[model samples]
Target: MNISISSDPQTIAENCADVIWAEDKTSRMLGITRDSVGPGTAAVSMIVGDEMVNGLDMAHGGLMFTLADVAFALACNTRNSIAVGNFCSVQFLRPASRGDRLTATAKESLLDGRNGIYDVTITDQSGRRIVEFRGHSKIVPGTHLAAASGDPAAAEV
Candidate 1:
């Protein structure tokens, strides 16, 4: 993919996230915000809405999973490479109600070649644990800046 890549670690991560965020319609639609991004780390926040509630009046499992997945995606792709989730598992701890603000923080656990593992923990505004998630990622054949204005150049890690 032809695109200009940043050299600075924080700038690269933020730039990569900018490219992703511009195309992440699902996250925008769900009111998810990219709270912070850095090399191998990301934090995304969202609020539980009535639409995301389950029959029991608690936040649906899928909603929380989506939040974690957003953070996981940002973390894995910060290295200037396009990455996709290979597998993921989430454990719901405390149920959240509508109006609760949750933040999912993803941190790199292990990185070996094109494969990586990330751990994501979701917490409510009060710092109560809500979910624990693990994601495996596989680097793909592209760069996050592929859609940016530029000719194709290799985005180095």
Candidate 2:
């Protein structure tokens, strides 16, 4: 809302990501960090904790899915538009243990109208692939920045 970033598409995307990350309590709670963002791309990282593991002593599948989902959501919403995930699927390739740091990177593979497809790869600190996630996102009826500038009428779909 402050318009601190320039009008360049890349800058706008990064700035929009800042706005989104600031209020993403779920990511913050999971110890996730927004590493970098650009047009149609984003990377987030998190560490596995004791509570994040299942009885098998491995990281929960949901935890990895959520990491990839966060990256996908940020990648699609970089154009000032708000996007929500409609569907997603994850393939677990390996296991992760406690204290392991994992990074999820998202790249937009297709964007048609209000629908977009993203591919997210989750890797361990050693760069070994852990999960492959695909997400479908749908643009919603709102702007991330302009609508929050004290003008209620600016929030048109």
* Clash numbers, per candidate: 2, 0
**CA lDDT, candidate 2, residue 133:** 97
Residue 10, candidate 1: C-alpha displacement in angstroms:
0.8
> Alpha-carbon error at 7 in model 1, in Å?
1.3
Candidate 1: where is the Cα deviation over 4 Å?
Answer: 1-3, 146-157
Models 1 onward score TM values of: 0.91, 0.89
Tell me model 1's lDDT, rounded to 2 decimals: 0.90
Model 2 alpha-carbon miss at residue 121, Å: 0.1
Full-model lDDT for every candidate? 0.90, 0.89
Q: Clashing residue pairs, candidate 2? A: none
What is candidate 1's lDDT per residue for 1-157, written digit by digit as tens?
A: 2346655678878988888888899999999999999999999999998899999999999989999999999999997888999999999999999999999999999999999999999999999999999999999887765433453434234
